[model samples]
Target: MPKKVVAETERRRRRPTRQGTVLSEKLIVQTALRMLREHGSAGLTARRLGAALGADPSTLYRYFAGLDGLTRAIGEELMGRALDSWTPTGTWRADLRSLGLAIHASYLAHPQAALLTASRVTGRPREIEVDETILGILRDAGFDDIDAVGTYHAFIDLALAFAALDAGALAINDDVREADEDMWTSTYAHLPPETHPHITATAHLLADRMNHSAYPAVLDTLLNSAEARLAGREG
Candidate 1:
């Protein structure tokens, strides 16, 4: 038998921990997500997770090789939720917009989980499926191979970047986030116009816009560029 297969077989053969909780991979991943929400990224240690699940920490290895393996599973879980909730509209531009928004919303929904997993290269199932779907969307819309890949790269990165950025804001305590938001009004809006003319001029706009996620506007800009490119090709 192959070493990898043999190792997996042995890991699965281990019985439940002393607590006798019948554990599964899904349960572990769910517990991890909850723990991340309640305690933040640093609090998601094996010991704490095991305690939450009422199993020994070592028992988790039966389902995942280690915490890193578990982290990748958590990332996959979030991606799966994003893909599952989205229904493509068949029009490529509109579909792409919907898909990007779905992903952004999913990560923001689980801010702490997004903070830990959004930037990871999971190369897992849901991630692969998302990549394939985006590539397919661009290719089917008449983009050549290079253009499709370029757009796919930018689209996925932009969504995940916003997810991470916005999730960071959400992951912070309400006090800090409120204070940061108020800074645009309290600090920038009141800036001395003589010394900071540009900011002073735009302070109201900044206060209105800066507190909101730029994901939707930026996503539209990206899609608009792609649309113009397609129009150019047709012309």
Candidate 2:
């Protein structure tokens, strides 16, 4: 290629650089989300992000206070996006299930980001909406204010716990149920023939019970307990 052609190609490839003017806070946060999706949490840093954006590393300060601030922003962005896309039908169980699964699926969609963001409580506008909606559902289902909020708290806690646990399991490259099965097998597969009487004798059945999904039975049990508890209570 000629010198003129080479120069033009380089110019086209160059990044925008107006120092403080070119990099907006919104742009930084937005780019961070995209980076999180592509590179995972550990890959995101101010210096690396600046290079990707073609701005000076120090210029990022105009947008975010630092790395921690950027992480929180990304968390809030993800939650906001998830909740904005949600619309509640009138069915209480259906709505609750939708909310729990939506959040879990969205988080698991980006495993690294999920692990980082799952533990945080942003208390942002979207979070407030979620809380209010949950409490309202419980109240409409015959719970009083205290009971409603208590149920809402339990629901939120369970969703967060499940999401966090799922993320952690995936982070270690383990299938959630499979990991539990392995634990049961490694610990129980070789019980002693003499010393431990009760457990050693039951080893065969224990092996049979291991490696299965306990969610169905456990959830059924929980549902029964909830029904019994609610049955005797006044709304």
Best by TM-score: 1
CA lDDT scores, all candidates in order: 0.88, 0.65
lDDT for 143 in candidate 1 is 95
Model 1 has an lDDT value of 0.88
| Residue 68 miss distance in model 2 (angstroms) | 2.6
User: Can you give the TM-score per candidate against the true fold?
Assistant: 0.91, 0.66
Q: Give lDDT tens digits, candidate 2, residues 72-91.
A: 76667666666776778986
Query: Model 2 clash pairs?
Result: none
Candidate 2 lDDT (Cα, 0 to 1): 0.65
Per-residue lDDT of candidate 1, residues 125-204 (tens digit): 89899889999999999998998999999999999999999999999999999999999988998989999999999999
Q: Residue 163 lDDT in model 2?
A: 65
